[model samples]
Target: MPTLTALSPEILAKYQPVIGLEVHVQLLTESKAFCGCVNKYGGEPNTHTCPTCLGLPGALPVLNRKAVEFAVLAAKAIHCEIRETSIFARKNYFYPDNPKGYQISQFDKPIAEGGWLEVPTAEGGTKRIGVTRLHMEEDAGKSVHDGFMDSVNRTYIDLNRCGTPLVEIVSEPDLRTADEVFEYLTKLKEILLYTGVSDCNMEEGSLRCDANVSVMLKGAKEYGTKAEVKNVNSFRYIRSAVEYEIERQIGVIEDGGRVVQESRLWNQGEGRTYSMRSKEQAHDYRYFPEPDLPPLVVGAEWQAEILKDLPELPEARRARMEAEYGITPQDAMTFTATRAFADQFEAAAKKAKSPRRVAALLTSEITMRVRAAGIEMEASPVSMDGLVLAADLAESGELSSKMLKQLLDTAFANGEDFLAVYEREKPQQISDTGAIEAMIDEVIAANPKQVEQYKGGKKTVAAFFVGQVMKASKGQANPAVLNQLVAAKLDQA
Candidate 1:
């Protein structure tokens, strides 16, 4: 086992961290990858399994057509070049959950390879992370250890997840910091969700990650002994595990010790990684072709059909929004992060005559209201027309920015018509310049000393007079108009 320690300043200054990630995403298929069993989570133990999933003798496997189509669509969406023909190979292993004594997965010839995902960095820059390969595999069942004098003393297994279709996206060691990793994961999840490939519900174990972390000299070309952190299900854990592992490895090397190559598990509750087992090599899996299933040949026409069905990905949408709407890159990125959010934003923008105002409101006022209400953008009661109406009201001076925020909150909560709400609220406005003039005259007569101060070149006292006039008019006096009126009145006083 490797000893865990903190990195010294010397090591931190001299070395740069290298990181790669292997993400396992369970496909949203109706059935198992190779069997007709239900591919659902959280059910009675073993209730969703069939003879094939249970690996009974003489039982054969059949590939689910929808699963393959989804895999190809995912591959194309990520900019990967799909192999015209891909084969399935058996990876032999001994585990209670893997009843077949071997797992069907892609080895030498995977379904997709050589792709890239662009992630946004904290400094408002973008980094292109290279995808090494994307392959298909079946998930193993979960091992539950519970119900004992001590929970650690007893162990149980649930085979419901066995044979579930999964796509493993392998990335190169291009990430240098934890922030980069976070951005990459977020962007990847957005793409996956937009494509309808996976639900990406981390709480239900639908998506998981294994991080490969190591430390090398800052400008060196070679790598270091890397530790594979396994079973990290949440983004917070992924970040913490990588940071901790980087410090641990650097400390060991600085103290005249060598880091070992091994696999570890992240204890999210404790916020650390513990040794799980030694890292296995390719030979350890005993890779061979599965006799039950034949090779999969994706013809050109099939690939073309999947490509035609692919919608505009996040990058394309972001670029289009930036170009067409003249919004900032960051705002465009935010708007296009989700399909539904992007669609709603576009719909609202179309209804709004002022694109700049629409963009600003969506990113600021609307976003703040949505966050305060604890609801998603798509679920907000404020419709596209409602937003357009709010923008128009603000543009027409019917509402100030402050009043617009209040109006948006009311609209979101009650889903009432904005015009009707405005009429009912009827916020006082300084529409009558004559009324404002009378109020100004009253203030001038009441505050003769302030008027004298203004005439003596004490310009700051003019604001006080304006406030008095506004107070007399119940905050309905237009401050701008009152300012001009007060200046003119004081000039002759």
Candidate 2:
């Protein structure tokens, strides 16, 4: 086993960390990638499979047009250069889950390449990670193992996910830290969700990531031995796996041990990587063209049509929202993280008449209330129109910040309109100076000591007088009007 040493500034200055990522995003098509069987997961064992996906003899594979279009859209969103023509090749391998003894995937000519995605760093800056290639492939069946039987082992196979369309996006080694990996995944997931290409939900296994991590002498010209961490399902796991692997490699070098090139599985429970098997080089897979399926030819007209349907992506939306709404970049990023959230924000802003105010409310008060109610932005009872009404009341001086919060709570809980609830509550404001003056006189006459204290230069006692007058009015008095009346009466004294 190889041991690593902690690199000091002197050693660090001679080394660099090179990282590359392979992301598998399952497309949201209605059918399988190469067959007409429904492309679903978690069904009964072998229920979703057909002759083609099962690799039965004489069963032929057919391409899904929608899947192809989705791949094209995804490539365009990432700013990849789409080729006028691309081909699919058969990657031959033997495994229990691979019934066909081969997997159909892109080998030489992939769909997209040479793209760039900008990720944020912990230091409040952005790093652009270059994308090397984006290719499509078919998924394999899942295998289930049971140890209940002592004598005979039980093994079950589910083919529901088999033949499902997948796009494997390979990135160049541009990331330097664990934070960069997290940011890259975050930005990538956001774009995929916004484009409607995939749900990108890791919990459901719709999206997955594999990282190639290696470290070398700080300024070394060549790279060190690399380890591939497979199937990191969550963002937290990605960070942990990468950090652990970096340290592990460094320890190997420090102890003068050679780091083996192999594939490792992330044992989340143990918080370490365990060796799975030796990693295979490209030639080991023995790639060859599939005689069954013809080359995929994407013409200029088809690519152009898909390009026209692409919507405004997250980065552009964030920039526009920050510039136009006068919100901070962080706030703008939050608002536009999801398409539905961005749409809701814009609609509410138009009605609220104050984009900045609406942004603040959504990001803070409304968000807190919604989370407490166990609702997401899409399912929240507070609609854009309802928020607009609340903003209107606050802007017109009809409600204070405190009152507005109350109104929002009630509105979100019962789906009641803001004005209707305000009417029922009938929170009153002291608009009449005469009425306010009368209330102030009664308080002053009742509390002579406090009144004398105010006259003797204790200005802080003004708040006490305001509280008394507000309390006497049952807390319905308008604070602005009460302040004016209190000041005028004090001046006379």
* Candidate 2 lDDT by residue in tens digits, 1-493: 3433444546444556788999999999999998899876677778898899999999999999989999999998988999778888889889889989889999999989999899877887877899999999999887888878697788877777889999999999998887799989988999999889899989878999999999988657788889899967899999999988887877677667878889999989988998989865544667888888888888999998877868899889989888888888989888887898898887777667688877777788778987898877777676667677776766666666666777777877787666567768766555677887899999988988987898899988989999998788866567888887787787677
Window of ten residues with lowest summed lDDT in model 2:
1-10
In the range 1-493, model 1's lDDT, one tens digit per residue, is 2345444466588989999999999999999999889888899988888888888898889998878888998888888999988889999988877888888999999989999998877888888999999999999888887766754566688899998999999999999988888888988898899888799999889899999999998889899989999888788778888988888888778778888889999888887888888764434787877777788888999988877867788888989988888899999988887888788788888777777688888788878878988888777676677778888766676665556766776777786656667767877567577888888888889988888888888999988988787677666666567789888888888
- The best candidate by TM-score is 2
Q: Mark the regions of model 1 whose C-alpha exceeds 4 Å error after superposition.
A: 1-6, 120-126, 147-152, 217-222, 280-283, 363-381, 401-420, 423-439, 442-446, 460-462, 465-493
- The predictions' CA RMSDs to the true structure, in order, are 3.4, 2.6
**What's the lDDT of the predicted structure labeled candidate 2?**
0.84
